[model samples]
Target: MSVDMYLGPSKTQGSTTTTVCDNYGNGLNSLQDAVGNFTADQVLRSLAYDSAKGYFKEAYVPLIQGAILVVEATAKAVAKLPSDYVSEVDSCDLKSSELEREIQRYETQIQGMQNQINQVKQLLPVSSERAQHLREANGLISDYTSAKAKLEKQLQKLLAFHAFSTMIFTEVTSLKSAVNQGLAQVSGGKGFNANKGTFSNANLNDRSWMDTIGKKWQDREKERLKDQMPNMDGLEYKQIDFNGGKVWCWVKKGRTTADPEDIEKSFLFNDWVARMLEKYGPDYFKTDREKGVTDLLVEQNLRLFEEVRTGIDSKTGKKLTPAERLARGASLVNSLAALGVGAKQITNVGKGKAGQTPKKPPIVGSGRKVPAIGKPKKTISAPGKKIQSVKGKPSKVKAPVKGTGKIYNANGNPDLRALRRPQFDEVLKNGFPDGTKLNQHAYNSLFKSGRKDIMIDDIIDALNSKPISAKPGSVEYINPKTNTSVFVNPTTKEIVGIWPASFKK
Candidate 1:
């Protein structure tokens, strides 16, 4: 059996022996016709058919391919007509989307920056607090160091006092022992009376008695040395209160209290010696010859003083060669004497003149007037006017009058004949003169019209048609409507009244 075939939107049944009729030709013709009426759907469907045929390797593929070819050719023709029209529409949509993304990104970035700034701002007070704490800690350390230094100085003073007290006690003990030994040697050879009456005779020179008296003196000295010993019995060496505390020590033949002043004097002397050794050398205190010590220094000082006096004397010397030392001494004495004398004279004068006031000088030439310094002389211009002068005063003169000696109206307008006609004509032709008046009518008209295009000639012609009778320098013009005098520029034709046309009169 035979059958017909159809494709696309129209379908037909066909015989088994004959394959589907190649309707792709009609499809291509339809595509070609549709190309003239190419809608987007037709183009998509044609492209799909070409893609299907290329995939299937069918014999009728040429028909589908031809459709693609026709569509592509038509598309190329459409493309040639300004691609920007399509691209511009697409680009505008793309730009809008891109702008939205950019704005969002910008806002996000701004928010992030603001967050970071806020975080940094929050840390400022904390950082400032830490810095203040650090400063306070540093100040505390400084105070501690100062207190430590002061304590060290106090400890050194205490150590010095302890050493001094110990030394004084040792010296007193040694003196007491020496006194005891001397008494024992004298007492070994003889025996003497132990009576207190033996001390009453000043000339009694018995050796035994002297030995007895010396033994007793030595005993008393030993007791005094013992009493003067430092009161270190119950205290540790470091804890001993040597400063301002009384120390009992044994001295020659008796117990006594050691003088705090004497002990302090010893310490002060020692300190002075030590300081002298440190500063000047150890040999500084070996001699008592002050004259020898001061001689060179005195000579040096004298030489220096002499040099200074010589310079002063040389600068101040008048006639004779100045004796440096003598001149300075004489000057000092004279200055002192002058001060005394001048003070006394001033006190004695006491609001009274020391000398008589000088009399006024007599006037010469009947006290005739002469001009004072820098004073301009006054002049009188009138022929019969007399120049007057008072005694001892300058003669007066009059000032010359300014101008052509002719008075004009207060407005500075000249007479009609005085106006320069040639200058006036030039000004009239060239618009307003350098200084000219404007009339009310022309002023109002020109300003209201705002007509800058009108040339100087136009103004001059307008005014020349009717010569206005007005004073020279007076602004005059013909009224545009009335053809009468209107106080515009007679010389130059510019509107010459008040400015700002809105202002009247």
Candidate 2:
């Protein structure tokens, strides 16, 4: 409505009793131009509130903040910064009231200083007008000094701001370069040149022996071995820490021999063991000893299983006919032997593996009365208090008296039937592998020699004293400690002599 709308009379110039309504409305556009406006920079500079100095003395703060925002926007185009702190920085502002308050504070300081100077001047005698002018001049100089100090403070702030911006630019530039270089290194067809590893590189995820040492080192080791062993064109070397020492493993690439046939055989190095070396590569077994032992057991069993399946004697190099092969594939061999066909009886039908002697199955027993397998175990009484103790030593067990430990039943008769091969049972009783002796068997027998420890008369007396009824075939005592097998005939009461265990059964 116009100015006439609210105070305009409903009737033209009509005189009426007092009827009043307040009209205080101002048009919406009346103050549009009068509204205050502020720029981003001015608002930033109005932060200080000095009683006398009023407002930001320098404009560098707003400039510094503006530069920071520009750099941040630039950085966002390249990569993520540590943090985008610019938005928080932009939120800070200065207004007139704060600046006015700061000016008032400084003004109060000036007033206080002036009063002090006036009190000193009053304490002195009265002076001429010219002298008074000189005193007033001193006051002006003091004011100028304070103002100069304040101006220098503002300049110092500008310098600090410049330094801050410089630092930010430097940091952002470094970040961008690092990110770009990293991306180009892997994605630019040049894969990272990280070490496959050294033994001491601790960053490895899998801490197995292989991973501890880098892949490059292993490959170099392989090449080195190949160069050293001309015969093993594909020689490989693996390292293992065993028995608190480092052991280097050597293996052939294929089933070929590295040395001439006439050379002394190194049983520890061979193709059969190489498979184990490969499986445990980089990933180490507990120690060198474990590796060697496991390799021995594996190769021995592998050969045994292979021979049984194919009916080919690995040692003799002889092949079996269809009938003999069928006999093995069938359970006929075990059944026949179970019925007392001699297990040691060489069945020519199964003659196999050429270029070697035809070997028989392990002689489980050597008597008509002995069954195929599984002989009873024996136990002996501990040394009793009745036996006098040896001087200077605790009561101890002497070597076993032969025939003393025979197992007996409630009937009081010793177990004299179903005999086991004593010599082998002693050496490999824990597990008598099916066919061949282990490679370590020779190593085991290195300390023992063959000889008759007990003569026939002594053996006979020893057995008769115990009242152990003898079996018809040879009676043997296998001593794993001595690594020897002593043989005798319990029924015949004769000594057959002692033999050292061999690598091959």
Candidate 3:
């Protein structure tokens, strides 16, 4: 008789269910039943002596011996039965019982042999390496399992959080939509209108009311948005002085019509005048006053005229004014005089005067002695008729001295030559010395007089006591003859002027 232990209340608490005490016993019985079904001869036939037989034999011998002992013990136990058990027993039954013992023994031997075959297979070549690989594979499997578990846990958590967040977002979106709809309804389907009112509203009735309160806010917002947007206001054509001084014209706000006269009037209007005063201050008006106003008006008109003229010409492809013809007569005479072309020569040319005709000299008294009119000539005879033809080489002709062409050589001023080399290297390094004042007209006069040999720098220095006031590159040397100015590049020392330097004499 085998004893079985029952744990208290095997059914889980609070769960109404029956627990099976024989479940583990049934599993063991099933294993035994399968083993018992095999025939002893069949189990023995399955095992053959091979390389695997050594391990099988080792195990099988002891197992067979133990099974034999068990069988004998069982037989002895059965033999103790009363005479009634013998009456029920048959001879075939005894044989079958014995055969079952043999089957069990054979099956034990076969199982041992199978274990030995597995062992032998493990002992094959590189078995240790294979074992190690299997172990590593097991370790990787463990790692993957752990990682999968962690990932699954994280995924679960994320799914939960997503559900929660989605719920919250849905709620918030619904709330916002509802609130917005409510606001729209309250504000007459236009949303919350902060500054909405009728044109005739009491607040808007006074123009100064908005000017007083909303101006600053509107200005700030405008500035903020202006910063955000690119200013694509087109090419703002501002009327500027030729020298880029004060602005002559500007597009007036709310003025769509571009009439030249109207534009001028806009510039001269009170608002513009007030703005100008504010920008330039009272002194600008006081000092300039009439001249400033006149200049502003003139420039405005000129700029408007130029704009209109350019637009018209572009459209028509024609000039509005005729070619300005040069007047002859006194104007020509005056121009020649201005050019320093002698007035008398021009007068003569104007009158068509011709040079006087050449006259023949008077003949002396015919074959008679006549007194010489002026000093008597002393006649010298040709050097005593040498009569000798010298047959030597001819004398060499001496070369004539070249003319120095009107250059003034200072009498005893050797220091003047030193001036050619730079003096006060730092002070006059850029140009002439400081405090130099140029005779404004000299540059044109010198060039006109054909004094080409005079260096421009020297002429500038000569005219000024100190340095030239002009920046190095700013010195515009104008040749009156050509009516063109030479623009000297300071860095490259490049002189760019009109073509044909001769024309610029």
Best by lDDT: 1
- What lDDT does the true structure give each of the candidates? 0.30, 0.29, 0.28
Candidate 3 residue-pair clash tally: 5
Q: Per-residue lDDT of 184-258 in model 2, one digit per residue for the tens?
A: 322432322235211121222232322222333345347445323124234443222222322222334443323
Candidates in descending lDDT order: 1, 2, 3
Tell me the deviation in Å of residue 217 in model 2: 5.3
Q: Candidate 1: which stretches are off by over 4 Å?
A: 1-126, 186-505
Which lDDT tens digits does candidate 3 get at residues 381-436? 22342111112212221111112212234673333223322221211233322122
TM-scores of the candidates are 0.15, 0.16, 0.14
lDDT of 1 by residue, 1-505 (tens): 1111111111111121012122333455575454334332334455444433332221122223333333322222222211221221111111222223333443443344344334334443456543543343334334333433433333333234324423323322433344344335334322222452111222223334334434544564564443232332222111011223211111222323334443333333223322332332212323222323222222222322333333333334533222222222222222112212211111111111011111211000111121121221342222443231111222222111112312254577543222222222333343341233444454334433333223232333234334445666655444332233435544554455422222332
Query: Candidate 3: which pairs clash?
Result: 40-103, 433-467, 434-467, 436-466, 436-467
lDDT score for candidate 3 against the true structure: 0.28
Q: At residue 347, give the lDDT of candidate 3.
A: 15
